[model samples]
Target: MLGRTPLDAPERQQEVFAAVLGVLAEVGYARFNMDLVAGRARASKASLYQRWPSKARLITDALKANLPELPQPDEGTFAEDVRQILLAWGEPTPFDTAGIFLGLLEGSRQDADLACLREEHVDRAYTEHLRVAVDRAKARGELPERLDADFLITALISTFVLRSEEQGVIEGIVDGLLRPLIGTFRAK
Candidate 1:
């Protein structure tokens, strides 16, 4: 008979979130369970169930809670703003981001709930921030009239995802890839 542990405390909730991420990273979504999170968090499984009611809800909330505050850079120049955003995006997390991402990808394939949660919670946030920067650049006439903001944002995000493991990749991507690409789209 598991009893409910109070999760009202902010620190307690953070501890649980950390545990959830750790378990998700280690075992992936299919093998992840409330019991594992409870053991790692030192809380009763019932407490988590009481609070979240479902695995997808719990995982989504935990990921949202752990996400870094998105940076809003107004460096005037679109290129510099993007460079700042990339630097902030590459900051380290407390958990294994790669492992958690892999787990989410695996779980999302089978679980509609998890898939929706990932798209809504994880992907949307990053996309929205990038969209803002692109919109600003367009408004300032820094980008070409026909430039595809969506394509630019997606390309920037993809570059970060693919080359993030390489050392100095953020600066390299900005200076070597992004700057050159943006140059092609500058107002003549």
Candidate 2:
């Protein structure tokens, strides 16, 4: 992406990703350009289109690469796993993800390819992490029998997202606001 064609292999992909992240950190999403990313990664413009299909997809893939995946929670308690993932999430600059996430949201409003990628990789992926957390609570007899998993997860996500611009994700803020709710989500 820096100025040439992509090299085939995981190592090359890492280099490309690193360059892209540097560009993102430097330019931010509002000013980001594929050409610039290509120049930075030294990768062919054609390779990006061939591999990702759109700027949104490419950036989304980059965002996913930069963040650690939430651990799969068969851990006997949802709170523990949820706590781990949320804490990890809290550790990162939440606003750093805004551009890619917003880009995918915009693209999902248009192209099906973009929408599918957003749904599967973004929405579903985030939801699954929360689901694993909820499932843990269910397993631990902590949640009500009729608890709505999606609603609960969405609400939790919304709390941070809604106030993010004003409040900022300063470490414990998200988890602090969320843990109270988690404590209260009992099976009816």
Candidate 3:
């Protein structure tokens, strides 16, 4: 009974994805719906369903594609690598995504589909980013050989992702938290 929105063509995938993110940034995940994305992308709802079975799946895929990659900094030190990671994610746009991320978290609690998406996509990506940098640090003798990258990353992410109503305060807060953590790692 629903009208098809033109997303069936394979070539339109990129447009569809862009539209998804735009919609997510605009209205966020809670108010977001397939129809809106389809309309924005000028694609069919059926085409979207063909590619992603649920809204969470669609958004997760788009996020993975759109989010900036966390590269292992080649600053030749663990401290610099950590600083790069914090700085890259501390940008205003990334901070804005944090709200959508929190919405995803709350939604995941009630939606099994979203929960799986967060675990498989978000968690894995976060772990892999930190793991690469930490492994490199260990190889360079900057960190203890047995240091747990996951725990360290969790601590970093907790501070990086803290909610802040005032955007201007974010840099100072992240700096205060990261300096000690980086120093601790450097001391090892």
Error of 3 at 159 (Å): 3.1
Clashes of 3: 4
Least accurate 10 contiguous residues by lDDT in model 3: 1-10
lDDT of 3 by residue, 1-188 (tens): 22343455455666777788777767766788999998888767777898799998998887777666666567776666766666666555533566666666666777798788777877777667667878997898767787777778777676567543445444554356645655787785
Residues 1-188, candidate 2: write the lDDT tens digits. 15343455777777767766666556655566678877877787777678877666776676566666656655455555655655555555533454445544555666677577666666776778788777767767777657888887876665555444554453344356544555666422
Angstrom error of the Cα, residue 82, model 2: value is: 2.3
* lDDT by residue for model 1 (91-144), tens: 887787667877888899989999999899988888887778888888987777
lDDT of candidate 2 at residue 92, scale 0 to 100: 53
Assess each prediction's global lDDT (C-alpha) against the native.
0.84, 0.63, 0.70
Pairs that collide in candidate 1 are none
Task: Please count the clashing residue pairs in each candidate, in the order shown.
Answer: 0, 17, 4
lDDT of 1: 0.84
Candidate 3 segments exceeding 4 Å error: 1-11, 90-96, 135-148, 162-175, 181-188
Kindly report which residue stretches of model 1 are placed more than 4 angstroms away from their true locations once superposed: 1-5, 145-148
Off by over 4 Å in 2: 1-5, 19-33, 73-79, 91-95, 158-179, 182-188
